[model samples]
Target: MSKPRSLSLAAYRVLSWGVRNGTDKPYIPRPEGELIWIHIASQDRQRVVEGFCQRLRQSRPNLSVLLTAPPQADLIRWDASSHPLVNLPSEQTGAAREFLDHWRPDLGLWVGGGLMPNVITRAEERGLPLILIEAEIDIHVARGARWLPDITRYTFDCFQTILATSPETVRHIRRLGVPASKVDTAPPLHVSPNPSPWPEDELIEMTHALSSRPVWLATWVQDKEFISVLSAHRQAMRMLPRLALILHVADMSETEPLHRRLLSMDLRCVNWDDGGTIEDTTQVILTSDPENLGLWYRLSPVAFMSSSLERGSGGRDPLTATALGSAVIHGPFVHRHQQLYDQLNRAGAARLVRTATELGDAVVELLAPDEAARMALAGWEIVSEGAPQTDHLIEIVQDSLDQRGQDHAST
Candidate 1:
């Protein structure tokens, strides 16, 4: 790599490390054979690629995965049943290249965009098979790349297989010289299926502590949505006086203001920031611990995916709520995850509310045992229907790998 590129990479690593304690996620070097390397640019979208790695590992246990992304996705949960996950050193393409050299991944999966051009070149030079899963060439990027046909072709030519989500992606890939035969239509990888295993003791404790109250959760709640949700909770409380509200913020920093706002309503509130219990009279519990959101969702039958009550906050994922059997409710602005929500809504698994009053009404109605159970059944049904998507993708990957191995032996 050139000096400038090397310096840029160094800066990237520094910024990533500074953002969070560098040691929160300790790195483990690559292991053995037939590894899959995934490079992701979007943090939110990284879950899809992770899902692919996880499912692939499930069917084929011996394979390994090396996941490299900068600050956006810095940590790897090292505890999954099979395979290992490692964070790539940011900007240090040399380190990334060296790691790949040692692991010698047979297949690479690049998710999302903005991957440096040289990274693709290095993988090609090493003869490592590359696939871009659910990839698209953004209009701004396509326009810029169009100015240089040679470079654009080189970028597009690097992929051995390309799975695209839309026609525009297919057109862009064709422009770069990939034969139509090599690019296939595939659904975006399913949401990762690993549900948080709520501890039996904790669940029992939560059940005892929070039982008999109608609990509702608003996850990843933002500023505008947070206020609306709090207001809705107050309004909903008129009908269901024992309503328990749980708020988990996308950023931990929002906890203080949210806490104060709840207190101003004279509603009993508690914060999990310092850790505690949900007392009998506690009206709201504010938490910044995201992992706790999973536990809360599992405990509550009704969940409102936040960042959706108002426009501009693109909305949050409802897959976890669905997978955990929580009846989901969201605002009308669910564009970021339209497909998942649409499927759930169509299945009668989730409801869309356009205003605070509507959301409050839905919460009150969903609290009914019969209604909540009905919604839960529908949500699970929709999730159950999509379970095979993960298996199908894994089967495709395995078959392709087996074919590649056979061809290599014949040649």
Candidate 2:
């Protein structure tokens, strides 16, 4: 390893020496396996990183991942049964040492370039292979650090590879004297274009049952929004008598009660989870099985992503719907998936409906074959545009891990 040309890191360590690292040790001990540590500079990158992790798991099979984000990150929990998220210790020597010792990850990935001199240098010293993606380095610090020396280049030596988000970012990194070969321009991470697979026979059967009727899906619907969704379906049906709705409750346990509730609302319905069949007169198909979502996404032309209609029900990820070629409809209260919903809205790939009446109008309008196809095309562009970039990053990570495994074996 080459020595840093400046004493900036040393001065930084001294300045932050006594700062208390607010991060706590996790209750779960480190499992014995090949673990990769991923630290994000901000919370917005959490979903993208999680997507990358999913692909990584598919490739590596048994690899474990540990995710860390800054203190300001208020990430809503999702399917974390396997991957664990924890607070990253503050960039102090003691905290860094304790964290590195406790986790002892096989590899580390720092996203959006929140380089901590203490943590990064320590990791490098321990021979951890580190990769930096979506680099957003503060290059002004290179000249601003006249008191100590070039700061950006000083810490960058720790990373084995660095992929910048844009050509402008590449120029900025290059100006700081980082090797051009190490800095490649890559696009921002996106939700994977390929979603989890569903049973194809079911999609075929559902397609046959529906007989190409104008269909819409309301997924992750909460109990509070039952009336709103039901009312929306009723209003839409006034325009298109053949429109069918798939009402998926967020909580599966509510299936029985929701079924009973729909019956009371005078809506002709079928409970798919209870093995009820969709009849020609069926206006609503109810389900809570997550596995069936993929089938519905492909079957439906338009999807009203529920949980956003009412507050406290964090908005659902719309990428799956879009990736599977369904036009998206969402509400205003999308705190969890704010960025994603905004992206779709801006691209004209999705419609925003704040009320049941508005949702009904939008659904009725979008369910037209041509209208739905146009919107689904727009959404498909949003997800597919980032596919090559995501695939490249996956390859980078896989190669790094493979090389590390070989090195460990040799030693």
Candidate 3:
């Protein structure tokens, strides 16, 4: 190691110690249940880790997860009420030892990157079962792995199982002296379906009330696309007089304005955020609370996912509605989730509409029972295609934990 690099590492250790013991102590007391610690090094890997953690928690109610990432990494966006988030300590031996001593995690899951060789080696030395997922060898080179090739090899050897994301990564891990049998290429973990939080009775009541009515939903509609959605709804209403539209605004403050706009246009609108009821004459149900999306997705057989119609507005995830049995119709700006949208489009589960007229036509076509059923079934299949992989990962984690328990009991 060069003198400057060694000094930089020493400074990092001192900073880590100060952060831990200073006024902003990031440590949270470990919960009573079996705890699993996940170390995430890059912001790009946070989404996959969050999804895996969500599925793990759902599968094993008794298990708790502790997430640790570098201070600069953008962690998971969703509310992490159950899982506690903390900053990973510096890779210095003392800082790593201090972190492990405080949390005492039963199992450690390191995602993407071998940048923290010292911390990883320290955990393995302490008899912790460490698994590496989505391992990237480029991170090793970027962190100057060539400077201490032997140390890099030793660190890679710590992981009991290494799941590489590509063939190149697999070869890279093999070059680092990891056993060939221990490293295997695996696909990136996909996001699992997270059902919206809505009451069952409310869904039932809304379904019963909207029985036999032509209905569609515009979910997470941004302000810029309001006119387009309204125009599509108006066009659809002309073809089917009893057409009902659910306009779920992305911004809560826009709910009142949207309701006023509908009323000004002589459309019978119901404001859901203000305890307004959907009567027989109601043409549009305006709501800003996204929590009630489950109800709308269930009641409406066809839905248009928003944020996609306008330029520069990257699309929102459509799986949430698809998982709830809604056939999705999206706009042209879905580059953010292009792969997923492409899969759905190719599977005949979703339709892409670039104009308001196209949106209306798609809505009208999917309103038919047979058309809606076919699309919904296809969407459901696309959403469920990754179930086997998710289940397999969960089984591996559970089995590892079980074996650890058995070993402890035997001792």
TM-score of each: 0.63, 0.91, 0.80
Question: Clashing pairs in model 3?
Answer: none
Which pairs clash inside model 1?
9-91
Best by lDDT: 2
Q: lDDT (CA) for every model shown?
A: 0.72, 0.82, 0.79
Ranking by lDDT: 2, 3, 1
Q: Tell me, what's the RMSD of every candidate? A: 9.4, 2.9, 5.3
Candidate 1 residues 22-133, lDDT tens each? 5545456657566677777665565566656766776888887777765446553421324455554433345446555666777777776665544565567666667777
Residues 1-411 of candidate 3: C-alpha lDDT, one tens digit per residue: 111234434433344332243544657777886999998877655645676787888888899899888744544544333578888764445666778888898888888874575577657777788888888873332233345435566667778888877999899889877789889987767666766468878777887777778899998899999999999998988888999999999889888887888899999999988999988888999998877777888888999999999987678778778888999999999876677788899999999999999999899999999999999999988777767667777887888788888888988
TM-score of the candidate numbered 1?
A: 0.63
TM-score-better candidate, 1 vs 3 = 3
Over 4 Å off, model 1: 1-34, 37-50, 57-104, 108-192, 395-411
Name the candidate that leads on TM-score.
Answer: 2
Quantify how close model 1 is to the true structure by its C-alpha RMSD in Å: 9.4
